[model samples]
Target chain A: MEWDWAFVMQILPTLFEGVKITILATLLGSIVAAALGLVIAILRRSKYRLISMPTGFIAEFIRGTPLLVQLYFIFYVLPDMGITLAPLVAGVIGLGLHYGTYAAEVYRAGIENVARGQWEAAKACNLTAFQTWTRVILPQALPPMIPALANYFIAMFKETPLLSAITVLELMNQARSIANFNYRYIEPITLVGAFFLAISLISVIGLRWLERRYGRIG
Target chain B: MININRLGGAVSAAVLSSLLFAIPAKAEDTLEKLKEQGFARIAIANEPPFTAVNPDGTVSGAGPDVARAVFKKLGVNDVVASISEYGAMIPGLQAGRHDAVTAGLFMKPERCNAVAYSEPILCDAEAFLVKKGNPQGFKSYADIAKDSSATIGAPGGGTEERLSLEAGVPRDRVIVVPDGQSGLKMLQDGRIDVYSLPVLSINDLVKKANDPNIEVVAPVVGAPVYCDGAAFRKNDTALRDAFDKELAAMKQSGEFAKIIEPYGFSAEAAMSTTREKLCSASN
Candidate 1:
C-alpha cells in the first residue's frame, strides 16, 4: 500500500492531542499507584492481621482481574450507582488501581530487603517509628523500587491505547477515528505505531538511566 | 526477607512468560489457517439484533447467523468473533486481528476502498430514535439541522455518521458516540435529540432501552436502501471470493432469507438487489 504523507500530516495534530491525554493519564496513574502501593506495603507489614490481611486481599484482587474489565466497571458500572466520572478520570483511576497492586508487591519486597539490624539500631537510638521508616527504611527501600516503578511507567505508556474503549481518544483511538473517517489506514495507523515506538524507546533509555543512577545510590 | 527474594523471582518469571506468549499469529495463507483451525476469526459489531454477545460469551445475531451457516457449508465449524465497532471492523481485519467481519456493516464505496466486501447479506434502512412524540419535529437529518436545538447522535465512523456529515449536518451539532449502547444511553439521558442508525439495529436498541419516552422516527429520509455484507481484508482475495460464491449460493438456496427473517429483518428487501449494481452505484 502506498503511504500518504498528506493524510499522515493532517492527522498528526489530532494524534498528538491524543498523545497528550495518554501522557497525562500515565503520569497521574503512576502517582496514584505509587502512593497506594506504599500504603499497601506498610499495611501488609503491620502487626495486626485485621489491617494486613484485608489490605493484602484487596491488592491481590485488583491484581488478579484484567485491566480491561476494571476499566469497564469503573467507566460504565459506576455511573449506574450515581457516580459519574469524566472518561479521563475513570481511565486514570482504573489504571492506577490495577497497577497499584503490582507495585505493592514491589514495594513490599524493597521494604523487607532493609536489614533487620537497621530497624533494631534505629529503635535503640530513640528514633520514633515515623523517623525510623522515613529516614532509615524508606531511603534504602526507595532506590530499588525506582527501577521497578520506571518499568511500570513504561508499561502504563503502552497500555494507554486501551483507554480508547471509554472514548478518552488516545493515540490508537485517534488512529481508528482517522482511518474510519478517511477510509485510509496506511498513514494514520502507521503513524500511531511509529509514535508509540518512539515514546517507548525513549522511555526505555530513560529507564536504563534511572536504573543506573539509583543502583549507584546504595 | 525470605519472601522478598521468592516474590521477585516469581514476578520476573511471570512477566517473561507473558512477553513470550504475547506474539500474535501471522496471517500467512489465511484460508489454510481457517481450515486448520476449523474457525474463521470474524470481527463483529457488538450491536443487538445484528450481533450480541450471549451471557456465556458466544455470539449470535442475524449477521453472524447467516455468516455462520455460509461458513459451515464451506466446511468451517468454528466462527470465532472479535467484538469491534462498525468503523474498527475493517481495520481490525486488515490488521490481522480477525479473518473477516460479519457486523451487518453496510456496503459503501469508501469502505470498499479499504476492504473487500462480499455480496449483500441484508438491506438495512437508516432511521433514528427521538424523544417521545417527536418534540422537535425532527423526522430527518435535514429537519434536525434546520433547528438550532437539535443535536444528532452519530455513532463515530459508522455509515449514518458519514451520511449525516455528508448531509450537511455540522460537526459541532453531531454528537459522535463510540457505540450503539452509548448512543442509546445519550438519547435516553436526553443529551441528544436523535440517535441515528439502521432500522433493524435501532429496533434492537429500542427493545433494550425499554423506555416508553423514546420512539423510532418512522420513514427515515435519504432512501431506505442499504445492504449489509461480510468484510475481509483486501489482501485476502481468495477468501473473499470464496465467501462471495458461498453467499450467492445461500441467497439462491433461500437459506439467507431463513436466517434473517427471525431477526426482525425483511429478507426479501435485503436480498432483492444484487451487489454488482449496489457496489457500483452506492456512495
Candidate 2:
C-alpha cells in the first residue's frame, strides 16, 4: 500500500503515549527483577535445605512457565482468589517474576566466580555475615554481572509488548487499535517496528559499553 | 550470524511487503467465478447470532445464513467462510483475501466509501453486559464516559468501540476485547465495567454464560440501530448487484425472515432499511 505520511502524523501522539507506558513498565519490571533475583540467589546459597531447596524450586517454576500464561493467570485468574491488580500492574508483575528467575541464574554465576579466598579473607578480617556479604562478596561479584543483567533487561524490554495481552495500553496494543480503527495495518505496524528498533539499538550500544567497562572483572 | 539474521529480515520484509501491496483481483465476471468455483469466500466474525464458527468447523449465524441463501439463488452452490475481526474485514476484502464480508459488519458513511454493500440484511441495536441490578446504571455510552473510573470492553474496531469513543470515553478506558467469550470473562472478573456488543450477540453470550450475577441492558441509550449488508470490493458492483437482486427476491419470498429470525435478528428491521439510507445516516 502507499505510505500515508498524514496518517502517520495523526497516529504519532497516541503511539507516544503508548511508548511512555511501555518504558515505564520495563523500568519498573527491571527494578523488581534485579532486586528479587538478588534475593533468590542469596537465599539459594543458604546452608539450610529448607531455604535453598524451596528457593531453587520456586525460581525454576517461574522460569519454566510461559510469561503469557503467567500474565493471564495474574490478570484473569488472580481475581477469582481476590487478588486483582490493574492491567499494567499485573503485566509488570508477570514480566518481573518471569525474568527474575533468569536474573537469579546470572547472579549465581557471578557469585560463584568470585575467588574462594575472598570468603576466607572476609572471615580473617573478622567481618560479620552482613558486612562480609555487603562489603566483600557482592562488590567483587557484581560488576561482571552488569553486562549479563543489562542483556536480560534489554530482553525484558522487548517482551513488554506481551503486556498488551492483559489489556495494558502499551505500544503494540496501541498500534493494533489504530490499525483496526483506520483499516490500515501497514503504517501503524511499521511505526511500531521503527520505535522498537530504535530503542533496542540504543540499548545494545549501552550494553557494549557496559561489557567494555566491566570486561576485566572476575 | 548477524549477517544471516539481517538477510533473513530483509527476505521476510520483501515477502510481507509484496503481500500487503498486492493488487486486488479484478472483478471480471465475478458471478461466473462463484459458479465455476462452486462457493464464494465470505468473511465472518465469531460473535454468535450474528456470525459463529461451530465446534465442527462449519460456519453459521444469521449473517452467513442470509448470504448463503442469496448466493445459492445466484447459482453459487455454497459459501466458504473464514472468521475475521470487524476492523480487518474491509482491509482483507480490499487485499483480495476475502470475496465478500458476510459478517455483521455494520454500514456507515466511511465504510460505504470503502466497499460496495448490498441492501441491509442483519440489523441490531447496542447492548451492554453488566453486573446484576445494573450496579453503575450505565444506560448509555455517555454514562460510561461520565463515570471517570469506568471502563468498557468491546471488540477491537467494532461499532461499540467507535460509539463509546465518539461518546467521549477516552481511548484507554475502552478495552478492545478479542471475542464474545473473552468479553464475558472480563466482565465476570471485573476487568471491565461494561462489555458492549450488539443486542442479539449479548443475548447469545448471556444465554451460554448462564451466570446469575450478570444482566443485559439492551437498546443502549442514545445509540442508533445499525444494519450490515454483504460487502464486496469497490470494483465488484456487478457481483454486488447480482447479490442484491437475489437478496430482494428472498425478502419478497419470505425466505430472508426464515434464515435470520431463528438467530434473533428482526428481518423487518433489515427490510425496512436501505443500504443508501443506512450508509448516509448520521451517527
Candidate 3:
C-alpha cells in the first residue's frame, strides 16, 4: 500500500493526544507498581503465616492470569459491584496491579540477595529494626533491582495498548479508529509501530544508563 | 547441534515450498470460481434482524436472506456465513477472506471508494438506547456532545460512531462497544449513557434484554436513514452486477418483500433508493 503524507499529517495531532494518555498511564502505572511491589515483597517476608501465605497466593493468582481479562473485569464487571472506576484509573490500576506482582518477585530477590552479615552487622551497631532496614538493608538492595524494575516499566509501557479494549483512547485505540474511519490500515498501523519503536528505543537507552549506574551492589 | 540445525533448515524449506504451492490459481471469472466451489463465503455481523447466527449455527437474517436468494438466482448453490465486525468486513473482502459482505454495513462515500456494492437491500434510520425517562435528556448525538460528562457506546467501525463524531462528540466519549449485547449491558450498568444502533437492531436487543429500564429513541436527530448493500471486492464487479440485476427483478416481482417482510424491514424503503444515489450523496 502507498503511504499518504497528507493523511499522516492530518492524524498527527489526534494521535499525539493519544500518546499523551499512553505515556501518562505508563508513568502512573509504574509508580503504583513500584510502590505496591515493595509492600507486597515486605508483607510476604512476614514471620506470620497469616500474612505471608495469603499474600504469596494472591500475588501468584494475579500473575497467573492474563492482563487483558483482568482489565475487562475491572472496567466492565467491577461497575456492577458499585466500584466504578474512571477509564484511566481502571486502566492504570490494572496495569499496575498486574505488573506489580511480577515486580514483587524482583524485589523479594533483591532483598534476599543482601548478605545475612549485613543484618547482623546492623544489630552489632545497636540499630533498631527500622534503622536496619531503612539504613543498611534497602539502600544496598534497591540499587541492583533498578535494571530489572526498569525492564518491567518498559514492558508495562508496551502493554498499554491493551487498555484500548476497555476504551481508554490510548495510542493503539486512536490509530484503529482512524484506520476504521478512513478504511486505510497501513498508515495508522505503521505509525503506531513507529511510535512504539521510538519510545522503546529511548527507554532502552535509559535502562542501559540505569544499569551502569546502579548495577554494583557494594 | 549442527545436525539439528540442518534438520531445522530442511523442515522450514519444505514448509515454505508447500505454502507457495498452496496458493490458489487465479480464476478467469468470479462466478465460475464460486460455482466450482459450490458455496460462497459471505461476511455477516451477528446484529439481530439485520444479520445473526441461529442457535443451531445456521446464519439467517434479512440481509443474508436477501443475499442467499439473489446468489441462488445467480447459480451459487449455497452461502456460507462468517460473523465479523463491520470495520473488518471490507478489508476481509479485499484480502479475499470472504466473497461478499452482507453485514448491514451502510453505504458511505468513503466505503464506496473501497468496494463494489449491489443495490440497496436493507434500509434503516439511526436509533439510541437510553435509560428509561431519558435522564440525560439525550435525544440525539448532538445532545450527547452537549453534555460533556455523557458517554455514548456504538459498535466499532459502524455508522453510529461516525455520526457521533460528526455531531462533535469527543473521541474519548464515544466508546467502541464490541456488540449489541454488550452495548445493552453497558447502558444497563451505566458504563455508557446511550447505546447507538439502527432502530430494528435496538428493538431486538431491548426485547432480548427484557429490561424495563431501557428504551429506544428512533430516528436520531440530524442523522440520515442509511441503506446497505452486499459489498464485493472491486474486481468482482461482474458478479456484483449480476447479483444486482437479479435483486432488481426480485424487488419488481414482490418476492423481495416476502423474504424481508417477516424480518420487519420495509422492502419499499430499500427499493426507494439506488446505490448510485447513496454512494454519491454528500453527508
Q: Pick the DockQ winner.
A: 2
Better of 1 and 3 by TM-score: 3
Candidate 3, clashing residue pairs? none
Candidate 3 lDDT over residue span B136-158, tens digit each: 88888999999999999998889
- Model 1 regions more than 4 Å off: A133-144, A216-218, B1-44, B52-60, B64-84, B91-102, B112-121, B130-157, B164-195, B218-224, B229-259, B271-277, B280-283
User: How much is the lDDT of residue A138 in candidate 1?
Assistant: 91
Winning model by TM-score: 3
Query: Model 2 off-target regions past 4 Å?
Result: A43-61, A117-131, A216-218, B1-27, B30-39, B75-78
Superposed by TM-score, candidate 2 places the C-alpha of residue A132 at a distance from the truth, in angstroms, of 3.9
Write one digit per residue (lDDT tens) for candidate 1, span B112-167: 77788887887788888888998887777778777876788777678887877777
Q: What 10-residue stretch in candidate 2 chain B is worst by lDDT?
A: B21-30
Q: What is each predicted model's overall lDDT from 0 to 1? A: 0.80, 0.91, 0.91
Every candidate's fraction of true contacts kept comes to 0.33, 0.74, 0.41
Q: What TM-score, computed on C-alpha atoms, does each candidate reach?
A: 0.74, 0.88, 0.91
Candidate 3, after superposition: displacement of residue A145 in Å? Answer: 0.9
Q: List the lowest-lDDT window of 10 residues for candidate 1 chain A.
A: A209-218
